[model samples]
Target: MMFSSKKRQRGTLNREQKKRRLFLFTVILAIAILFGDYHSTIASSVGKETLTMITSPDYPPYEFYETKDGERKIVGFDIDIANYIKKELGFKLKIAQSDFNGLIPALQANRADFVMAGMTPTPQRRENVDFSIIYYEAQDTIVASKSSNLTKPEDLSGKIVGVQLGTIQEQNAKQIAEKVPNIKLKQLNKVPEIVQEIKAGRIDAAIVEDTVALGFVKANPDLQFNVIPSIENASGSAIAFPKGSQLVKPFNDVLQKMKNNGELERLSKKWFSANLTEEPLSTNSPPAASKGLNLDFRRIIPDIPFILKGIPLTLSFTLSSVFLGLFWGTALSFFKISGIKPLGWFANVYTSIFRGTPLLLQLSLVYFATPQLTGYDISAFQAGVFTFTLNSGAYMSETIRGGIQAVDKGQFEAAMSMGVSYPMMMWDIILPQALKNILPALVNETIGLLKDSSLVATIGVVEILRSAQIVGANKYIYFEPLLFAGLIYYVLVMGLSFAASALERKLRRSD
Candidate 1:
């Protein structure tokens, strides 16, 4: 009887405990739900609607690059106006980044709901994408070297002009070039490159929107550039909504309010020094007749003058690292090939660490952290060059090792049988053949260095991308300037590609 009573008590206690746990869990879950709701955005619960926003964070004073500093937070006029629209309509805003040309495709593919990258609403772009009410007015301007004698469209005759790809300025420059007969236009992806090229005298002049031209001039006060006062056609910049978006009316309503309430003017003054909200669609305005100077690209290919000033710095850094990498890679390859246990193991570990990690991270560590650790400070450019070389070396080592191993063992032994010195044999025979096998890859690495040089911008090398950003931020036409930069990069990459192809053909013929 006692045992039965004890067992019954125990069973009751277990049931009570289990019930208590269940009750606690239910309460906690309810609290979590309430907290989530409390923190939810106004449109979080709204179903069947999402506002997808795409932008490139390369420009400043408009839509500059976002950094971890929270200072890089989106505070430009675009964000302000977009938020106002979102508030009025009660739709969630989803933001993304799209390339200058990719914005429309993203909208078409349903990857983005809209684009707000300071896009100028042009007739050609309208064929593919729908734009909302014009939010700002803009004009095209020329950026040129101050020393250049170009004063008018006719002055551009027989000069090299730079412009952004896919922009009204590019089209205008082309039209003017066609009419003028002597001017040549070089279209690029980013504006900074144009600024740099102009400063370096790579191009005689660059055509950009007025705002961006102002930015370039501001950044380079000592760099003389004349801004012709005669204005180009003025165009309206508008938020491009996806085709058939219901959000357009709501956005337009907010934009009208912003314009009416002077909020738009306030933003424009804060960023652009003047209001661009009025007369947003005056694309037929005359070209700038101002006396401002800008970049000139009129000379022969390679812009020999600028190339002479800057390409040496660029090539010097590249060759120094490339040659160093070749030496280190060869040593590592030999170690890996030696069949020696510890040396091979060490070489493998070295290759894996560098190959597995990002070059940017390594650059930061070496450039920023190395000073703290080793008490030696290196220039950002040098660090960038060194980091690239080291990274390339590790990858190249594997290529070299593969090539070395690929050579027939019989050939090596035949030289040995001839009692040839090992060093002489390698120099006369093995290295020559191995180099032939690896020449294609070496050339690829060189081309890669050209692109990677842009990364130097992160550490402040003012290579093409940084120069574009500096200029874009000056007047807030981030898209146009970046487009110019892209053109420079494209031309460089294409030229290198052509050379690589020619080199490959030559090698094949020799073979």
Candidate 2:
């Protein structure tokens, strides 16, 4: 009886201990989760909603497109960090691509929440946007032909040094020029272009970042890069947001956590090990430019479908722009002859400004300045279509006005003699004749707009030119893919021409 009592007491004690251990484990887990949350976003949830980020994906290891197993994804150090932060903050992340020059503009237009393109935060940039704490440090390099022996900043004296437009390196080159004599800066749009210029001897040297320069030199043994000595304010890449954004504090918090937990170091190791070519979309031999631009279409066969995907987008943009331009142009033509001083003056001034300024300039202003000036988040597509429409309207309005005036005055008199209203007379008698007269010119305008659609690539529209650029950047080759894209544009234009000719015949038959 004593043994039985002792055994029962021991059993009850064991059960109590088990329950206590389980309760303790739960408490510990809860605390750990709370601690993680606190570290992740400063204990506040900036969670939910998808955030869009803009980056110049041409810069690899930082952010570039990877094609694997027939699937394409944007993969790089920045993308990984972004994903981790999104997971921590409980938000979905969408990445958008743009030219390096367009990255800040995209942010200004609210086309993206932030930019992470290995971009250094310079004073000029800080004036327009806010930046998070520095995440990675990179040095500028002077890349030149091994034979040119341009290793130092002083060596670039009396040389045409190339730098990418709108880059911190451009600012660096200017500073160097102030110190070095006779340094003529030649600004280009891409590093690849700068490399070609160096090879062609058009430019003696280029100011490129060390990480990017490393990959270029490796791909082309003919070139070498020497790191420029660190500058006074040796700043590094930080996440950039629109000026006065609410996301500034939260992004900074997440970045701080990444720094403390060594996440940033881990990413730096993964990406900084090699340059862009380490993640080539094609495994074939590199382009044989040394052999006088030896063309290789086989290397891009795997990427043909990718480039073809741009067709639909191109068509949509072109059609939308052309139709909108037609409508707007017709309105402006009416205003030109409306005899209302205010409307005429407004339309005339509008035409003069759009006509006087370059289309590219107008597009940039509409895209970058719209958000700040209007507080509306204008998208890349919207900006492209709107700019094209306005430009086409400026040109088409004059054509339309000429077509309208050329109509026989007797027709207006005849319509009025029939007791027709002014609106009815203009709509029925004047417009039909004017449209017929301008049909060929209208077709020409359509063709012009179709070609001009390539400009949208500057602002990150994944149309023909941008897709070709992506493939070329991935393959470390330029000419073949661009030729193919040009061929596609040619075929499209030819098809459009055939269709227009057939439509003209049909309209003549109807008459």
Q: What is the C-alpha lDDT of each candidate?
A: 0.68, 0.84
**For residues 137-175, could you state the per-residue lDDT of candidate 1 as single tens digits?**
866666665456565677888888988777667777876
Question: Cα lDDT of model 1 overall?
Answer: 0.68
Instruction: Show the lowest summed lDDT stretch of 10 residues, model 2.
Output: 280-289
Tens digits of per-residue lDDT for model 2, 1-511: 9999999999999999999999999999999999777655642455336788889887766777674333457888889988888877767688888889888877767778888888788888999999988988888989887777799999999999999999888998999999999999999988888887887789999998877777677666567778899975463888899898877788888889999999888788778854432642212333334736667798888888878888988999999999999989999999999999999999999999999999999988888888889888778899999999999999999999999999999998899999999999889889998988899999999999999999998887888888888777766677888999999999999999999999889889988
In terms of lDDT, the poorest run of 10 residues in model 1 is 299-308
Backbone Cα, N, C clashes tallied per candidate: 59, 0
Which candidate comes out best when scored by lDDT? 2
